[model samples]
Target: MSAKPWPEGTGCRILQEVDSTNAEAQRLAPTLSGPEWILAHRQTTGRGRRGRPWANPVGNFTATLVMQPGETPDKVALRSFVASLALFDAFVAATGRVALFALKWPNDVLLNGGKVAGILLESAGAGGTLSHFCIGIGVNLVAAPSRSDVDESAITPVDLQSETGARVTPEEFLDLLAPAFADWEAQFSTYGFAPIRQAWLNRAAKIGEVITARTGKESVVGTFETIDDTGALVLKTASGRRVISAAEVFF
Candidate 1:
């Protein structure tokens, strides 16, 4: 129902009967910059990292952003926290309470003990002069897919059941998300990950508790030590300190 292109630095939105927002964003990243450069009405094949499919039914916010700066991939790892902070703030605005928002590592937003949103970042080109990159975001606003469509237990904005039991709109969510995302992106761009790390830990689900992590061929339970300068999830192991590159964790 939004009539005009949202007047923001990153508000390059278009309507499609259905197209994967991630793909659309990647296809457009070489051009647009900032906040939300691409968004899809319905995603036929929205994907997450590791070949997971991101649910993109109507009404949920399925968007992607183009991130470009003078940093290497390793240096810009803080983007995860920045993106999470944006969704966290959006959750607070939606429910008028911050207690329901929590982070599940790198970039997953949990609500009421269920996944409400996730972020997927990918690169293009190489080196510091990268062509462009895309950060795909999927939020379960109107409906949550069945277990078969999601890797984790399902959740829906309908859980809020807004008096009419109708779904939440993408517009309503984007209205709150854009400003919050811009704010956090500004912080991450200005400062570094140190401050964001503390903010992230404040809402992190498994900060001081034992969590299960599945890296590749092994799975272990350990206390999450901390996120180092480069954004690696450090786990204190019995043998020694182990910093993991990628893993599926549960608390």
Candidate 2:
């Protein structure tokens, strides 16, 4: 059970099955009066960054938080960090082990040095004005895909049950996650991204360590310095400090 209550006026819906929660979010965006969480018991067509297939495998966690954030695209996008911090807190709340988890830059949560959860952001707009934004998250709670399921350069996937023996259902985990996210969202709303960036850095994986960030055919290898105020990944290369807005990070 979450120590904090769900944020007032937030809505939650659980479906026995769906093609994708993000898709559902897009469809529900126009009708939502406030932020809403959509969770699916099973996703027949789950997806990851770059439209890669995401393995569902039943009993895992798959959901999306949809809301109308009336902000610039860049500002709206920083919620990925907000979501990352919330996931960290929810994980700690579930297992009572803070030392076991670390957050990967950009949008991944690491458990025991392996990828345990991932975040994907999507938005709708016209003429550069925003309409709605969705943060889709997936967690390996009871099962993980085979090594062959992921790209060769990707980190191995780990599940909560396998790694920590914590048995958390999708619904129960959402109960923990939604409130944690609300708290961080409140912090972000109040103090801006300064506190969120610092908080994310404190729990960041590979901070101050050598890492590789790949963008298509190009790759930069450098020491993980920090995430800039704008949420860009800052790497200290021999050439200089490089700020990357998007890329796949590997340790």
Best by TM-score: 2
Show the lowest summed lDDT stretch of 10 residues, model 1.
Answer: 155-164
- What TM-score do all the candidates reach, one by one? 0.86, 0.98
Candidate 1 residue-wise lDDT at 82: 84
lDDT of 1 by residue, 133-160 (tens): 6777888776666666544523332233
lDDT of model number 2: 0.94
Candidate 2 C-alpha lDDT tens digits along 1-251: 45578778899999999999999999999999999999999998989999988888789999999989978999999999999999999999999999999999889999999999999999999977889999999999999999988889899999999999999999889999999999999999999999999999999999889999998878999999999989999999989999998999988
Model 1 clash pairs? Answer: none
Task: List where candidate 2 sits over 4 angstroms from the true fold.
Answer: 1-3
Please report the candidate that would top lDDT against the real structure. Answer: 2
lDDT of 1 at 144: 69
